[model samples]
Target: MKKLKQIVNEVKDRIAEQTPPAQLTDLLWQLICYPPKMPLRLQQEQFLNQAETFSVTVHDEYFTKKDLQINGFKWGNGKRRVLITHGWGSKAADFTELIAALQENPNLEIITFDAPANGSSDGELSNFLLFVEAAKAIIQKTGAPHVVIGHSFGAMANVVALNDLHITPSLLVSLTPFILLKENFIKSMTTVGVPADAQEAFLQDFERKYSIPASYFNMPDLYKFDDKLNHWLAYDEHDMMLPYSYLKEFLEAHPTIRSRNYDNVGHERIIKSAQVINNVVEEVNKAIAN
Candidate 1:
């Protein structure tokens, strides 16, 4: 008997061979925009159950071009509001440890929400653009926060949202962020077994549909908005998703931005590190103080 994995691959190959290029292009878009949704784990649910839950609507003029509602949670009734955004394919409840650490601040009203197509959000597909829209909508509803904490693509999306909305938090804590959208997309294409020609076609379709070049989403383009914004960047030396060198150039360019390096931790594990949590807490305190 053929292994289940082998069968799946054979089916995918058959689909690719039989499907028309236009049809295949649409499928490629779906593949990139929609990642498998991860349900909240038992511990995550337990943690979120203790907080006040609600929903907010994200509005956009293109693509979805409609109001999409996403679920959110608020912890504490403190004066300072802090917003937290989770990474791609990740749900809001994944920040349990960070939430616990931030809860130490009596005056901090921390907020976290599931992005579109993630967790309890009402969607089947999502991209960085959608994530940015969601973040902007939440910020608008919650008002300006004291700090914005984001993990991986979540961090990049939040930065883009802040730039577009002209909202600047006192501090932005970015964990394992990537600067080049093109590089990320290339990696995604390779992971999904997209051929080189199909990759080009995908980019063309993306640009045509969005009316914006895919390259415009790069870190340099997004960060052009606010040079005055304070940043607290933390990344692991061993992070496989985003190489250390990609960020080193940006860090060196902006010496004022505070950064911390984790010795043994990788991308996802760094979030659960107590030391990382402590560093984040310290920055939150500093932001609140200022």
Candidate 2:
């Protein structure tokens, strides 16, 4: 935490040093698009070290059309497949517990990959579209899985990917998702002390680069692409990363969507919860059975 503060201070200093408006916008844009390379915590490191003991197969360089190579993992040989996607700055190994729990089902195949610029994947930068494309590539390669699971940003990415690819899974589990990308980006910029003018400039540049309107990054609008889609949404009221109001508004609008509100578990820890894992496995089992 101290190191992160130091880095943030350094960035703020650099921003303060820039005299030109264009330079400041460019710098902020670069910082926003690039995922920070965070060192693995002790538990994450230990998980990776003993990953082989979990009896999963590793694909060192799974190819995508954009020539990006993603590190992929597979468990079980069953015909019923499940794909799990991790959030930004998180790797597939982070899902070790969930993967292990799912392994209890002998008739299931689980697939997960490290998105480009994350984990063992090869890249220095990534964006929302890149995440969507990576998920599409994996689904295209493995075929549509029975159940699709995503956490945070990955949850939003999977929704976009499934709609674009015209591949619908039997079940989709979205864990603590950000409903609006533009809002999230602006919030991050404000947290890092980016000026409001610079934030606006970054948003304009982002839309120009992606060739999509900032409003199009909304999850509820994307969900409209397939209204019949079965969604299992899980969120915590006190998640520090995402305000509960955003989700509460979404649920109020779409009361038919299945959801579970957890207490106490914040953003990241929600994925690691044993209860959440069990619920996920049960949902997957039920989805596959049908």
Candidate 3:
């Protein structure tokens, strides 16, 4: 029994010492396979990390949910308020640059939140609904007419809130949004243990884990062809998660949505770029005026 224990300990030590497998290649393949979803998730995470270091900075603070104190930053008593959300795994800080840019106008109030478990916000990692709830909280606390913009997962959260849950953003902007490619997402969800032919089990597990309906994965078709989307601030020339073909299809399905695509830009850079900041400010001004 003693020798058996020794062997087990050695095995565990070796397992711990060995280098972990590289998830990068696997992640890339997943992007290639899904074309859009996984890439959106990855970009959001990286964007948030950048915000923590060098990218856009937000009015970041930790606040109590019970009273919503220590809420994020604000400047200029601008009549038009804007609530911005970061992509998946992103913090409010990711939109710092945009916040700064828009704040310069002196006619706009900027609000941003660390989606649950992000930035200084306190919450469970699995509470995906926190994204939408936080956005609403920002608007209510500020008490201003607001336009809401989100990147990637934040965009999806906006959709669920506006379309599925019925919370309206005076003006809504979704960047590099994920609207479909359900099967690939389900494949990733398998890590939690759903098997083939067990779609119901997957939905239940998803709801329990993230509080999101599986129908989010089974979203309706909404893409229209547009070479202009390739110009979006968030597209990589070499490695694109969702190529132009996909965006064209997505826009076609949702023509009522207003959007602009910039040239040869990838999602994260677009979020952090000066040009995008200007573009957002321009649009927010228009939204407020109209």
Question: Considering every candidate listed, which one attains the maximal lDDT?
Answer: 1
In candidate 3 the C-alpha lDDT for residue 42 amounts to: 58
lDDT of each: 0.82, 0.79, 0.51
Task: Tell me the lDDT of candidate 3.
Answer: 0.51
Question: Which is the winner by lDDT between candidate 1 and candidate 2?
Answer: 1
Residue-level lDDT tens digits of model 3 in 214-235: 5555334322223322112233
TM-score (all chains, Cα) for each model: 0.90, 0.87, 0.60
Q: Worst 10-residue stretch by lDDT in candidate 3? A: 30-39
Off by over 4 Å in 3: 1-71, 163-170, 181-184, 187-204, 207-213, 217-239, 243-246
- For model 1, how does the per-residue alpha-carbon lDDT over 1-290 read when each residue is reduced to its tens digit? 13323433643684578655555676666666765665678899899999998888876444477777899899999999999999987888889999999999899999999998788887767888889889988888888888999999899998888888887788999999868887788787677576767778878888998898788887866785446778999998878888888888878877777898998788887789999999999989988988
Candidate 1 residue pairs that clash: none
Q: In model 2, which residue pairs have backbone atoms overlapping below 3 Å?
A: none
How far does residue 203 in candidate 1 sit from its true spot (Å)?
0.4
Candidate 2 per-residue lDDT over residues 1-290, each given as its tens digit: 34345556766986788645456665665566666666677876676564332212223231233466776777788889899999987888889889889988989988888887787777766777778878887887778888899999999999889888887888999999978888888888799887787778778876786688677888778775445777899999898888888888887778777999899888998899999999988889898888
When 2 and 3 are scored with lDDT, the better candidate is 2
Location of the lowest summed lDDT over 10 successive residues in candidate 1: 1-10
